[model samples]
Target: MGKGPMGGGGPHGMMGGGQKAKNFKGTMKKLLVYLKPYSISIFAVILFAIGSAAFSIVGPKILGEATTTIFEGLVGKVTGSGVGIDFTYVSKILIFLLGLYIVSAAFSFVQSFVMSGVSQKVSYRLRKQISEKINLMPLKYFDTKTHGEVLSRVTNDVDMMSQSLNQIMTQFITSVTTLIGVLIMMISISGVMTVATILMLPLSAVLISFVVKRSQKFFKTQQEFLGHVNGQVEEIYGGHNIVKAFNGEEDAIREFNKLNDQLYNSAWKSQFLSGMMMPIMTFIGNLGYVMVSILGGYLAIKGSITVGDIQSFIQYVRSFNQPIAQTAQIANLVQSTMAAAERVFEFLDEEEEDQFAENPVKINNPMAGVVGREFQEESNKKSHHHKEAEREVAVVNEDEIIEIEGSVQFENVHFGYSEDKIIINDFTANVKPGQKVAIVGPTGAGKTTMIKLLMRFYDVNSGAILIDGHNIQDFNRHDLRSIFGMVLQDTWLFNGSIKENIRYGRLNATDEEVIAAAKAANVHHFVKTLPDGYNMILNEEASNVSAGQKQLLTIARAILADPKILILDEATSSVDTRTEVLIQKAMDNLMKGRTSFVIAHRLSTIRDADLILVMKDGDIVEQGTHTDLLAAGGFYSNLYNSQFEDSHEEAV
Candidate 1:
């Protein structure tokens, strides 16, 4: 928690360039790796497809053989050469062909089963990995990307990969296998016709290849346009209040329409390109079929092949060319899945700090006595593992410390969101810890940035921060933060009971403890007066609850945690004056015996503060107690006098 408001490199920075996306070949290789986990299932799918393809050629072969046998029998009877062939053998052959088709159908079903499992499992696993990465990512990542855009990646992109999996893989195996098997059968039946079919293929292949490359370009653009549209919506909805307050509705509408227009154009092109595959493939397949029929029939008439042989050769030719055409389109889907894989893998590649450390501070039952059996048991465990138990023990019972003396001391801190503009400006401050330090300044005056630095959200560019005698970097982030409770001006709460919102401060706290915390924050009576009492449900971000209660709930949360430091940024600015008075008492109770960093707007709040540091342009202009600063009649005095001298005293 680098003296910042929260554990983040204050959320003001843009995303730096991320990992370059993998190209087509790289994407295909990575896509293949997802199949590695389901190799057995994929292998089965392929095998079934191979069998189905191989069996397909058998039907046409048998039909051609039967046609020859039947014609031979007819010629024998008519020519009085009945002994030339046996009629019963042809009957048996036809029956055998019937059995073969049934088997082919069965194998086709098994192929579907195997491919479905492979695709679904792989997609599920990849989504899980991406979800885990999102959790492990630092807050800085979310600062650049909106929740909705990120949400789209997880859902739409992943679904694209999953949806095409079975179709692509199964089609690939069947198409390629059928093409090879039928080609071999055709060669045996009539080599002349086989040569002719092969000759006509290269033209169609080259045309499809050109179209595929074009399609990929459109697909890439289509994906980017989607992200842009998602970004626009996320921003517009998230900043709805800002748009309304500033009366920039026209500007917002125009921006949204621009993004939406681009999305529509890109989508149309992408769909058109993808839709071209089937038409292009079918045309080529038909042209090849016509070529085989004409050439094979001409060869038979020229006594180069038998009529039955020509018929069978034509069937094999259609079987062969048909799958090749289908495979071309399936190849496009395979490529798209590879593209999705590139996106998914890029997310997982981001480096995350290791979460599971060997030693972390554990706060036992809070109400447990320092020397009681429960405390001793927890103490023994802490001393055995964390190694900072001694200091924690001393601070547990006392409010003050020696080295820090309610003062946050920065030795020589230097930091930035990146190597870009430095926000802290070689920040060094002797903020007396536990002192009511009021930081007042204009927006972006490094006010909230100061809180982020002290919290150690990001490692300082250089230097050390000491709390007590300990450098902050050595402390566990969660444990260190447990000592300070922060209530931001913009409050956020989860969708749950009001009790759970307050209980978030101490997850294991009892109902009684929760009620006690609420009472301390003057919210107990109000909650009891409600229909559900403590069990009342709060909507997402606590929108179901009033603004004042939301703040009070957070205050209760802080009181429950009972931290040594409290951070209140415009804590009372959101509620009415009557609620403010009620909350002021609660705030005082929560701030007692703790170091408080207060970012207050009302001059009345700071007048009572132990130290009022007037900040402007990211630097302190004046510092002293309220009276002393007013006596000097400098910047602090002017800011103080302005409140009384100023009009529009509606509320904070």
Candidate 2:
């Protein structure tokens, strides 16, 4: 019979959904590639499974000999033919049969032991590859896919693969072995009985195939709905406070119920179809059993077969149906596993970021500009201070100084999130070392997008971002990013001690350094008042602290990083006026003598910026010092005046 689609197969049993794979054959082939390394262990497992099945297949036949011996002896005694029962011979046969069973059990145990190791190791390796793949994937992937979907693939899908692997291999070998051995034993005793039993196979196959075809679609639907449910739950829980504020809990529950209902409809149908396999197989087996009994009796009456042979053949008939049923069950499991494998392999094959260039630049010291000895030795003939006109174009540090001066320039840049829609077009700007540049714009005017490009989080569609007279892309991504520190609007603090959160900027920093950074950010006194001082643990959301205090902790982190360049994206926007003043003071200290890019929504904050670039519709509409822009009376003037027009008129 064709197999029913596979759903969740372990303790959840029929209640679980069946997730059918679209490309079963292709996915299985890819999965086998991973098993190549464990081939030797798998081969040994196969041998053990075969041996175990072989021994079990011989047991019924051997036990029949003892049955026959006891019967003959009893019959002779009843007929008074001077022959009595041979208890010793009967006991010997029974002992031999028991020995065979013990051996079979041992083989089965060995097979299970070996296969478990193989499955777990394969799972371990796949998890490692997936972990590494996460780092290689571009930010675009995370942006496009939900957190729940990615997490399901990594955890649920990988786990499915591991459990299914253990079951499929051992069951497959044992089923085949038992099927073939039972057929041979049955035929050796009575061909007519064997033929009768074999005739029912086609009928069972027809029933199973019909059910399988109908169930496949439901299984596929089940998985899709399951993912949707997970995504909705994750979204609702993550933003539960927002949901509560907006009175959206009912809507969230409604959405979850819809997805859950879809899952239930598909799950029960797939479960019912698969659950029918064994009962139907048992009916077919009973039919074969009755037919074998009648046919064997006729053979015995014709003197063509002995009583012992008929008994042995009957046992074979019963054993034959079991493996047939097991094979069908395993077939269902195969579909589920293939579906999971497809997802895992799809994730592994995702496009990775561009490869690192050979001899990429390295920033050995944050404060110094000295080139590595290797670079200097290779180009020893070049002087440390080569004239700008004489600089080599082939290498990033051709001028021999590997130091970053924090000077940044965007030359004729053009960028778009997609090809058809350009956002920032032909924008160019230059910031000299140790200058504070403020970018002010309306929402969606490409202020933050520029910072992303500057960090090489996403490369520009065209044109170059140069740092210290070298293109940012020319340096290793790790080395290039190390020179800059960012404090974004959304503060990220993991569940750890307060001190540990601050030390995230520099993992190896000492306690003294961490305390100094906290003092610099003006949060030291507040932390000292806490119950545990710096040792106080922050929960997952860091909700134990106020928003302003969380902002302070992030500022302290940036201070500890001590980067050559700093990017602040509205670092004070979320706090109260008093807290904003404190944050501004801390920021001023942090920005001292460091090239900084500040993205501000409040016009008042950028009044003293060295340069102010007012943005409109992805273009820089005006750029100058605040006073120069006010004197010019351009778009910047209108935007700045709009904020305080009422106050200005009242003062007049």
Candidate 3:
């Protein structure tokens, strides 16, 4: 039942070779902290496992008693001695052995059950922590990491930790208990045979160590190639249409085949090397078993040990090497688990955004300058006149002492994605409440960078952006973002009904309000044409709807938000001419009463903008009304003129 020391599960143990984790000790120590909560359950598991393995360890000795009894009975009968067989003694030993195995099985079952729950609970908590960590991490962290890599840490790495931790904990306890109990029983029977068995341990260990050392490089390479192949598949599949359109199918296949072949080579080599450990360990174990058996028989013949003792010692010697092999396997599994845990721990340890202030800004409130209800009477009393008292009541209703005027200004703002390279340099702009300010620039210009700075996606290296005369940093990120809404060229709609997508901008918006917003965005008619109207479900990528329709939905979302400021990033760039006209009209309606920033490639769209900020290489080269800039015959005029010239050249 216990594999008698030489028996084992499989050679998959060696497949974990070459994965010696960096900072393994520290990672394991940190991982153990997560286990602290389940200490009681883990303790119970260990106890049950030890009991189970101990029962198995003692079974062979008891069975040996029965064997010796049978042998003696036969010998006595042949020699014509009195009272030849002790039937009652043999019967009792057989019954006790059966009971021992049953109890051992029960203990093992309980250990597995308890360990299952502990592992699952830890997995749940790890996932919860990762979810929270995602929100806490800054955008910059995501910008630097691949989405697949991040997801692997969350899903694959955590899963590995969960599975390996469960098995390792139970096996480690059982193996140690079995090894100890078996050794003690062997020594009690025949010390000489025990010493002979122990001598083979060093040889078995050295052999395992050699194979593991050779296989580690293969394992690491296999993992790397596996990742490369997976990435290639994901990229090629995700862009299948593009690849086909470009007639690059052969190239993609060739690259994939190359990576696949490399992965196969490493995988095969690693497995072969790891597989060698099992048979090698088995051979060494069998050698020890043979040595113990020979000495055991000699000792019994010389009357130094009984036949029963010889049988039990042989069983011990046979079982000894399996635990040693198991120990080596567990050690490798631990290294693998630690590597995964390190990734998870690193994610958990990422830098988080600043804590929200106790008294966060209230720009979302229409009357943001108001204090609170407690000061209402005092403010009313201070302002005696009726109009003044009314204003006082409004002022007292809001907590933060900030007004919501929606006037935004960039005051000598300078910023860069990286510290060493400055992308936006000492640029400044001002937009009055309800003004439409358009930013126009060449491909390398800092139009989007300016928008990102305004939204605090990336903080400026120097200077500041202000809303209603208060520095952007003065407002909590949540409160600050709540005051502005954005509709970008890339529309994002989750897997939900069209109505739900619109309601996402303002979660508490009613069905009627959603319809009104859709109507304002000119997508209401299109929705009505669908069988389910607003209830139509969008697919995961929102591909069920047309690109233009998706754009309209986003605009509808932005309109529903009713933010004090709006940012439109090429919002109508992807639509057909007719759809573009509808989108432009909807966007105009959305921006009517909000201070808006528009970044558009189309010069015609921004011709009527209140102020046009023309940029080149992070600098505001020209800033004025479109007519004024065109009349001045400067960079703005040339940029505006080049559009028609390019079209003419293309037509020719």
Per-residue lDDT of candidate 1, residues 1-652 (tens digit): 0110111010100010011235878776767776787888888888989998777678988888888888777788889978766668888988998888988999999999878888888778878777756755766777777565566567755776776787788888888888778878888887767777888779778886776566555555555665666667767787899999999899989988997788677666656655675677678767777877788778766878776786787677667767876765565455556655676666677655333224333334243223233433443343211123342332233322122234567676666788786665555566666788888766677777677777655667777776765666655455456567888878878999989989988777899999999999999989999899889998776777788888888899999987777889867776888888878888888988788888878877877788776776655667778888889998777776777776546453
Error in Å for residue 265 of model 2: 3.3
Please, what's the RMSD in Å of model 2? 6.7
lDDT of the structure predicted as candidate 1 = 0.70
lDDT of 2 by residue, 8-91 (tens): 622323322355678888887878878988999999999999999999999988887887787788888999984888989988
| Candidate 1 lowest-lDDT run of ten | 8-17
The CA lDDT at 85 in model 1 is: 64
* Residue 265, model 3: Cα distance from true site in angstroms: 1.2
TM-score of 1: 0.78
Rank candidates by TM-score, best first: 3, 2, 1
Model 1 residue 543 CA deviation (Å) reads 2.7
Which one wins on TM-score? 3
TM-score of each: 0.78, 0.88, 0.90
User: Model 3, range 75-102, lDDT digits (tens) per residue?
Assistant: 8898988567788999999999999999
CA displacement after TM-score superposition, residue 645 of candidate 2 (Å):
4.5
**What TM-score should be assigned to candidate 2?**
0.88
